[model samples]
Target: MSDRNDNKPQTPWAKNLAIWAMIVLALIVGVSLVSGQNSGSDGTVIAYSDFIEKVDEGAVESVEIQGQELNGNMTNGQAFVTYAPDDPGLVSRLEEKGVTFNAQPAEGRSLMGAILIQMVPLLLLVGIWIFFMRQMQNGAGKGAMGFGKSRAKMLTEKSGRVTFDDVAGIDEAREELQEIVDFLKDPSKFARLGGRIPKGALLVGSPGTGKTLLARAIAGEAEVPFFSISGSDFVEMFVGVGASRVRDMFEQAKKSAPCIIFIDEIDAVGRSRGAGLGGGNDEREQTLNQLLVEMDGFDANEGIIIIAATNRPDVLDPALLRPGRFDRQVVVPRPDIEGREKILEVHMKKVPLAPDVIARTIARGTPGFSGADLANLVNEAALLAARQGKKLVGMAQFEEAKDKVMMGSERKSMVMTEDEKKMTAYHEAGHALVSIYEAASDPIHKATIIPRGRALGMVMRLPERDEYSYHRDKMHANLAVAMGGRVAEEIIFGYDKVSSGASSDIQYATSLARNMVTQWGMSDKVGPVMLTENQQEVFLGQQISQQKNVSESTAQLIDAEVKRIVEGGLARAKEVLTGHEDQLHALAGALLEYETLSGDEIKILLDGGDINRTDGPKPRTIGPATGASAIPKAGTRAGRSDGEPDGAVPEGA
Candidate 1:
């Protein structure tokens, strides 16, 4: 049944041609009827006096009268027509002249002409109605009467098919889904061992973690029919429409048994019922209820494996997460070092990479990059190489691409005063100095005074390896590093002359300090208890019903603790900069000269060594002393205090 429906031919052209032919026929018939009426009078015209004179002279053979008009045949057999004035003696005159005449009624329409004239309007109306109905039926799986039909599309293997080999960096998720594919390919193999086929699998992860890609890979590997749809496709403004769509979708799936149904971003329709204020949405709740039944209802949906992807599994309904509905929950997390290296290799296959480009090194530099981010990085590198008119993407291009993705594109065209440049140099140098001097902080990756994105200057740090959890000493070191810019400005330019470049720096430091005190329980006074309230959505009923966890006294204590943490970091930064003023000045001067410097260059400059930059900055390998970190750029513009750029900060920066 499904195959026949899929193979059905569309006859829009034929239908339109038929309608046009009918209209043309109707027009021809109408034209012929009008022309026939006009051509009915084929005789020559004669004056009334001439016609009467002919009748009196006995020259007329016969005459026919209709109202005031008369038609007669002369003795010569010629036809003539004439109009007569009101003459009551015409009949007697005709009789005396020996002319035969008769009275006749006026001509009326023929039966066929009348029927054609009436039916033309009805036929035109019917044709127009059918055209509109077909148009509705052909649009986005919708029809004039099929408003509740499912919009799920059956994905074919011919359209950019992705196999398991194409998916990288998410081995665990792939392995879990592979079993389902195996069962789909040979269900009897699993059945021999008393194994039951899993009903569904849920792919949960952060955005860009390759959840949807993995789902597609499963379909490709299994070589089965794939039906793909979004959760939003099941929902509509009208009530009960979503429920009907769910039923229709499952019916289609049943026809193609042993197929996969992939639903991306299922959170849109599977959110918990009665969760938000005003008792939640009735229509959405009903839709979710229907979906729940369809997944693991009384009647089994055998041979049909459901695959769904969502980043927000926390909001999904509890019933949907049970064992029978979604038998497996696959977590596709961001790739670590090895996984990133593999992912980079996968994307680099399409690009012409130079001999100097090493995937492992680039992967180490990008510690927490996802599969999608790695692909973007490779693409950006290729674009950079293309812009420079290079035939191959080299290590230098990859380095620059990584920097652009991690921070932002350099704003070299932005005009800055000489004084602002010097200040920005000093500010960035301070951050580098603190990161270098502090033992617990990550190593400085690079320092630059060039304007990038919204920042006037920025100093970056990278971990020796991927650091999942931060230690207390590391957090304290990070706090000092964050305060480095402001502390440098206060010491060099004095408190009254300090600029607003430290606004983002202060915001970042304050947020870190608060999280440490209220959330992390790093504060001695706050202890291990969480004093901060869980942030809920504004529309959620719990947000309105719940009160703050902290009292007035506790709130004050938290504020004081956050302030103390920030000030301690400031004092530490001041102490470090005060002791190493000469090195700070040296690093700042190098930044002003080169506009940018790597960690090795900064180290060389601090040690009173000159860099030979005639060949450009040399590529440095990631080592124990080399790493990367994201720091918000300081704003230099006057009367603009809020310095945070839109989407400038990276995740966990």
Candidate 2:
């Protein structure tokens, strides 16, 4: 710190003196030009006496005045009043004014002298600036040569700005990497017990799980020199540049000995050997080879650690992950509810958040969201609040932002037909009704027919808080709920064409059902055998596995299981809608009439309440009424809209 201040050099006095001298010289030249002008003659007029002298007498023309000027023929020594043809000289017809002019070749130094004089100061300034530039650039050039140096970042001590406190979700993975951080901080302690540092660690997960952020924390904690580079950075256009960079990086790491190097998206250079070998000389493959060689060559005692991150770790070269190179693989998966709350707190630091906004609730609403998404959610929430001209991010804004991110901005202007609005309302209500009656189903968090994203309607639900793993009952329940919308459309509207809005829901449900039969132990015909190996989807920080588990006979059974799951749900939806046929017709008519209905308004119609009572749904209740206006308000009214009161379910089954 002392040297930082003391190193400030005293600027050369001669440089300052030279600059001041130039400024003074310019002022002197300017003053001389102004003083040399004529006295008593108005400066406004342009009287070209020299031009008048040069012109032939035959070419003379009488002066003509323009723009309030009184111009006379040029009279040289006296008033010969000689006029030049080019001038079309000042007119004598105009009203006389005090304007007069005597142009004297815009007097100053001669052309050569002015240019020479001006060049003196400019040359001095340019010379001084270039002198400094070369001095700085030369120093910079020396550092540039070091580009071949290793870009592996470091994290030594556990005393970094981010600790386990800053991390959320994927607890198992976090705990595992924490130990590595501890080992680096005290290698001697581990060595005393014959425990040694692994040469490298690979982090494999889906995108947005904060893999890179964790690496940064490691660097901060280790308090060691950290070199950060992309796996892509190791590659170059030249045939051997990749390998050369790899060698230079390792050499630098050897010098810094106790440092850390982080290579993100290692799959870029670490793809399977011979996978893309057009020849053995491909730049990416060469980089991977050099990396493998260096990792194997570097001794454990050298104290240099390599950490690489990739979302597509499955495609990486196996040699890079083998024992000699990356000894451990850490998986950073999506945050759970608790993890999400912690992450929310971390990201909410600068947001002016409402005291009542609940992070846990928001987290529950957002399943499968990565740290990056949560961060984005928080930012979107802030923006939402700002749009409302609010100082703090409120719960409503958070919910709105969540909807915007998950779905899309409200298409308030996308007008729907009367029949379309009613269809959407019943379609959405059907999902809520089936889920409510199903014993194995999760509680509905939100159910709306509001058109959002690509959906004309939607319903968000939550599973039992304690369910860590999936079950047969839950899976069946999900399938039923997913089919509820289509079933509602058919049961009420009759074998009518279904909208493609439920395409995603069906796809998700189908995948889950397939997994249940083919992979998870929930299947009746197939046992718990893995159908596919775990593949790392790096961006999400999760392990995605596939299955080839079922035999041909069992494959038929699996398809049956999937269809059975979907049909059961659809049948349940049909049964519910048919049971309340009168109410269904009334609600649909109301939806057609209103063109939009909020959850409360729809509930009122179902509850057979008064139409004038427009109070929205109670906070605790969720149903077709919840946020229903998002649809009905958007179209031409052509059907009945029944605003009914809320009601409880019948006594028992």
Using TM-score as the measure, the top candidate is 1
lDDT of each: 0.78, 0.61
> Per-residue CA lDDT of candidate 1, range 330-355, in tens?
99998877788789998999999999
Residue pairs clashing, model 1: 461-628, 461-629, 462-627, 462-628
- The deviation in Å at residue 459 for candidate 1 is 1.1
Question: Model 2's lDDT to the true fold?
Answer: 0.61
Q: For residue 367, what is the lDDT in candidate 2?
A: 65
lDDT of 2 by residue, 122-189 (tens): 76677566545544433111233433444443333434456566776667877777777788777788
Off by over 4 Å in 1: 1-122, 136-140, 276-280, 360-369, 395-409, 490-498, 510-579, 615-653
TM-score of every candidate relative to the true structure: 0.75, 0.64
